[model samples]
Every structure is written in structure tokens, then in C-alpha cells.
Target: MLPISALSGAPIVGRATVASIRLRLPLPEQLPPAVRDHIEAHAGSQNRQYLYVPSPVIADQDASAPLCAFVSIDYASDAETELVEVSRGKMLKSFLKQNFSRDADGDQILAALFHMVEHLPCYLLRYSDVVAAAQALETAFANGDAPSLMMPVLPAVENVELGWGDSEPDQPLVRRAQATVVDLEGEAFGVSADQRNIVHLDKGALRVLGLFDVRTREREVVDILSAAFPTVDAAQIENDVSGAVRRFRRAGLLVAT
Candidate 1:
């Protein structure tokens, strides 16, 4: 099984672990060096210093309203995962479309939890060769980019071993085929015998996907919205709220107890 950290696009030449932060408020100058360093790394990669807050509240601030200082780096990548150049065409389009459509609705938490739970099963498959699988998914993402429904997914595999002697029958082979179990974040997920490669879609990974969806939703609302000077688009607000619900669900980070 491949390490979950490896799939996060954080294992750049010098990084240690992928970092993810959820921003509720802007970052202050008093932030610790570790936090500051991570933000700097992210900004530097994109050749930008800081990201602006594009929310309605910030955009619609009046002259008399109190001013805010800075935008927060809510999410960061893991250190062990390195970001590669990926063309976001098909999956991105589907993801965007589903996000913007009026009928796009679900119990976000349940959906997320289901997805996460499903991950355990998906990884157990014996994936095909890495290059072929990666290319296929990448192509799928590129081809599906028109309306943004399915979002792009690039899955990576590592630490693979065969459960049975499927290589050759020359030698006396006697072994029971067991489902491949990949250790992801200390938890094991089952992969199928046909899926030789492992694709990890963990909390941080899904969060990034959700962010893209949220961004699209915001774009749709802002484009069609015409309201008062201080108005926030209803769609945008709903999307944000629902997104929170989804994230909470995805992480299984909710509390019903």
C-alpha cells in the first residue's frame, strides 16, 4: 500500500509533510514562524505574496465599515506530497457544473463520509500500471472540462506487493489471494486485485476539490446577481454554508454524541 502522504502533492524536494489549514479569519503578523513559513511557501509557488479575500463581506465593505488586515491561508498541502503539473479539464468541469447547478443537493456530511469510507474499498484493487492509470484519469479530467462536472483526479501508487504468485507458473506457487491493504494515515484501505495502483483521496485532497467547487459556485452567483450595494449573493452564501457541512461530513469530523 502506498503511503497517503505521498499522494498529497507535498513531497517536494525539501518539504517534510503536507500542511492544510482552514481559514476562518485573516492571518495576523503575530503568526508563528512555522505557519508563516508554510504560507510563504504556498504563495511563493504561485509567484504571489498574499491571497486576497474575495468574499462578499470584504468586497462590499463600505467606507464607514471597519477594515480588515489580511487574508488567511486556510489550507496548505502536506510536505511529503509534491505538486505536479496536471491539466484540469474533465473532472474539473463536472465538479464545477454540479456545484453551480440548482439541483445539486445532498447530505454533504453523509456524502463525504460515504466517499471516505469508499476510499478504503477503492484502494484495495490491483491497479493497472501507474503510467497508464495516471494518464487515463488525467485524460478524463481534460476531456470532461466543458461544464465542470466530474473534477480532475490524479491518483498515485506506492509500496506495492503481490499477495499471490501471479507472475509465472514455472515455480511451484501456492498462496491465497488476499485483498491488498494500503496503509493510509495509519488506517488500511482495501484495494481490488485488478487495481495495481493506488489512488488516495483523503480529507485534504477532497477539501481542495471542494474549494474549486466553492470557487465556481461563487462565480456563478456573482455573475447573475444584482442586488443592493452591500448585498451578498444568496447562492454564494448557501454554497459556503453547504460546503462547511460537506467538509464536516467528509472528515467524519462531526459530533452526534
Candidate 2:
């Protein structure tokens, strides 16, 4: 059965099918002052506890600002209680690389990573790969490679190729256009190298890498796509081209102007 709690993070696809139980509970306004005091006396003494404040009084004069909700996590002594606490909040650290570092907001980082994985053909790292990378990181830490569990893997995306190599020179006789992902960030959120590491789209990405010779301006991308598929419509070409740009740009290959 699906877990039930006060709040949810990410998106839940469906509702729980368990039998609903009604309780004879007092309404917030109807509760007596002594009962309220009794409830407050025992608050925050147990594991997996959550307090939802319906309305809060603000002492500051800036009352024009919208009311903001707060989430609190209390330490739990039991395993089940700890798991429940973790599940209540969104697991932002797992999905967002920026969460691993300072300077980025947790929500923004999660949103960016979500957009990349959803739209792009990014793959999640397998158990084996994650383990191997973990070991490598541990060894590095021991040998002074920076004491941290930082496993950076640049995985491939489907139908997208990433690599480094020579480009076909511009010539009138050959008309060969070599395409490489130079600068990828065109939109607010894009498929970046970090996202690539999380999602493994390697083989297909490698194949595309083999085809592309060099990375250039966004406009130049059209030239490469045209050269690769001469008969492809402009619209069709545009879609893949934009994705490529975003991926490469996120990888630091494409520099911002």
C-alpha cells in the first residue's frame, strides 16, 4: 500500500486505496484552552512528528508579504520513524547536483535537474556504476584526491552524441559541416553534464559524438543537422538541435556569450 502522511514531495501519480477512517476529533476553534495547552505540552517529544500551522501571527510590520509555510524535521530514535521523516520531504539532494554544493537553492536545483531528465534522454546511473564510482571516490579521498564521495560520470543520452575531435574544414567543394556541442545553455533549464552523469544515455550519445566533428554557434547547429540529414524538415531538425545545444552548453562545451 502507498504511504500516507501530511505532505508530499515530487508528484504522486495516484491516491491510496486503503479504507478511510474517520475520527471524532475536536475542531481547532472548538478545542478548549486546557486541551490546547495539554496538546502543546506533549508536542515535539516523539519521532516522525509534524506541526502544520494553519495561520501564524506576524509581529513585523511587513504584513503585505504572503504567508509562508515552514517544514521541520525532528530526530527519530527508530528506523521506521526516520524513514517516515525522510519520505515526508522531497529528496532534493538525490536529484540535484547543485544540492551537493553551496550557492544554489534546493528547489531550483531540483527543478533544473527534473527538467533535464524529463525532456532529455538522460539515464539514471546503475547500481554497479554507482558502486564502482563510490569505490573510486573513496580511494581518491584516501590518497588526498579530496575527502568526499564525489563520483562524476558523463553518461550519454539517446540519439545524442558527445565527444571531442577535429571538425571538417569549411570548403566550397566539400560542403562538409562538422557539428559539435560547443555551448548548450539556451533556455532557463537544460540538460547539462551533471544531468548526463545522473542519467546514462551513453551508447547513443557516443554514436552522435562520432558523427559530430566540432561545436559552434546555435545558428551553425542547423548547418550540421542539414548536412547530416539533407531531406529532414527544418522543424524536425530544430527540435534535436535545441536539445543538443542545451546538453552541450550544460557540459561547459558551449560558453555563454
Candidate 1 lDDT, 1-257, residue by residue in tens: 10111112222011222233333334554456765676656542221343522221222211121111111111232222122322222222223233332322332222222233333212111222333444544553454322211211323423344332122212222211332434433443323332322223344333423333222332333233323213876666545434543333232322121
lDDT of 2 by residue, 1-257 (tens): 12211111332111343322221223245355764665555443232433422112223322221111112233222212211222111222233432353444443343344433333222222222323434543443354321211222323433434333322223111101222222222212223433432222233343333334343444455566677778888777666655554454334333333
Clashes of each: 54, 14
TM-score, every prediction: 0.15, 0.25
Please give the TM-score that candidate 2 achieves against the real structure.
0.25
> Which residue runs of candidate 1 sit more than 4 Å off their true CA positions?
1-230
